[model samples]
Target chain A: MDDTTARHTEKMRRIKAARDEMMKTKTEEKGLIIVNTGKGKGKSSAGFGMIMRCIAHQMPCAVVQFIKGARATGEATFLRERFVDECRLFVTGEGFTWETQDRDRDIAAAQNGWEIAKAQILDPDIQFVLLDEINIALRNDYLDIDEVVDFLLTQKPHMTHVCLTGRNAKPELIEAADLVTEMTLLKHPFRDGVKAQKGVEF
Target chain B: MDDTTARHTEKMRRIKAARDEMMKTKTEEKGLIIVNTGKGKGKSSAGFGMIMRCIAHQMPCAVVQFIKGARATGEATFLRERFVDECRLFVTGEGFTWETQDRDRDIAAAQNGWEIAKAQILDPDIQFVLLDEINIALRNDYLDIDEVVDFLLTQKPHMTHVCLTGRNAKPELIEAADLVTEMTLLKHPFRDGVKAQKGVEF
Candidate 1:
């Protein structure tokens, strides 16, 4: 074999060996509680993406929107129309906290949303549950972090995955989660005076 | 009006006024150069989500895979099968960097991949272009950062959005980008001894 082919072969062999070694210990499979939080865009977008991933796998999925539920979003509209059979979406929030301006009302709405999410979390048929913007509810003290954690710990079905998305995730929830991603702000067009557009931001 | 109804009405009026004021300033529409980078997962997955968003809008899209192209991924397989008319997926990498090992070959592959990407970026018919893992090629010095930035700045179609996904995005690229999200590592299942599963990781 030529020098290049021989080098590539040797390198791939090393990679395979290392990957095999890593795989040897990676045997556990269980439900994953994934949290997407931080002060940046795409947290909810990523969570929505996971719902699509679930659909691609032919898994039944449910989306429970906590904030930004007063009006329909492009994602909710599209998913409902396109993947009607495989997905169930619940928009339970009255509106954004700032819009509601009533703590008791927000808390009540959050409690109602959590009830929907809890039912999905416990459902064996639903393999992926997206609690979109639920972090904002948790941040606003609309839902008790301890209560949410206890429910997640106790209610999630085996092999089911739950994704929570929003900014300022609670420390307790972060600690309890199996996977967490902090979408850090780098640069945004809003800083440049750009508006949120359909098919992009929503 | 009842006390709670009157309060909610006042709050919603205030919100509508603020929203209208914000909407007044958001008028410009142009293609965005989006960057998803940093040491975290979901960058490429998020990009793929954008591709889906484009597809939902009935817009043509293309994905140019830079690194993880040695094998067929679930995203590629599903998209190719389902959205055959609306999406174009190009897997142009020989393999991951460690698996390839040869600097010269990697550079050549990156150069070739960039050529494909350049064509897609300039295509007016393609509304969304996802450069999957292109940042790794840039980080490895396989493609000249300045050249890539200049091309992105100069040759991009007026209405085509480009999303670059990977870790270690160059400062020059970030400066030129319209939107940037850094996916910070919070917690990962791989660290807890879980293998990359078929539908989830790919």
Candidate 2:
């Protein structure tokens, strides 16, 4: 074989090898977890992307936003109305923890959300779970980080993927996560005294 | 009557209103396609629980399985491997087109294998495209269907999801797919006598 032909043959060999690996990798379920943190926008947005991917593939998923509390955002409104039956889209909200003032009540609400989340995470029907703003809740003691990590690890071998988002992710949580992505904040409209943009921030 | 209780009540109302409309409709992008038909099981198993739910969350999803891919099995393996990436998986493969066959190729070969499959359906980054069984080489006029579909569609929105798998799916081409799933039948070990398992065959 000449140069091009030789290259083509070599490429084919590599391709077959890779295909074999892929087949092997795909045979068993691989669980995943992504922690989206740091002070920035779009953590939840990233989670939303995963949700959409799962729906397109016909996988069942669930989403629970702790601090968000159903804020009438365009995304929540759209998904709740149309795709709920097809996918598991749930928004259990108690509003922002700091704003609520009743620390005990806030903790209780977080616990409640955690319970719901716990059930879904373990449910075999649920392939991916987006815990929107979960990091913040864990930081504030609204939810226990240790418990969350424990559940994640226990569920890991089952092929369940989880995405945890929000600011102030604890060091332990970051270490425990399979993929920890910190969305650094270089600048923001909020810092410029501009209010959160509609369709951008809840 | 105190100020604290009054503020809490107001916040509660706001949260409720936001969530009530969670049932409202939202915008959607172009639909996607998922093909999970094949002699092997787990085609739908792979697609249904991962990428499908992602779209269900308003990511814009459309799934078309050429064969009856949605017979739910108590043991679902394909859908569980999606915790790491959601918007990246799209499934489209029909185990085999029963209607097409010829003596030249008993099983899908290079014409349909790595060659046409690569030329046709393998664009890992494309938003959505699933070629389930372009593997039926000479049987289904290998290379033709794969090339045509690859040439036709536009890959965009960056978050499109697709899935494909099945027996005789061209190897070379299927390799190019962002994600590929193959159901290797193990110990259906049913001796020529036993009936097929229910919830196992869809």
Measured by TM-score, the strongest candidate is: 1
Model 1 misplaced stretches (Cα beyond 4 Å): A1-16, A100-105, B1-23, B102-105
Candidate-wise lDDT, in order: 0.84, 0.51
DockQ of 1: 0.45
Docking class of 1: acceptable
Residue-level error in angstroms, candidate 1, position B2: 12
Colliding pairs, model 1 = none
lDDT of 2 by residue, B1-202 (tens): 5786678667766765664444232233222332333343334433433333343343332233333223322222233343223332223222232222222232333233334334333444434433333344423454465454454344323344344434565544443433233333322222222233222222
Q: What does candidate 1's lDDT look like per residue over A111-132, in tens digits?
A: 9999999999888888889999
lDDT of 1 at A160: 83
TM-score per model over all chains: 0.89, 0.47
Clashes of each: 0, 63
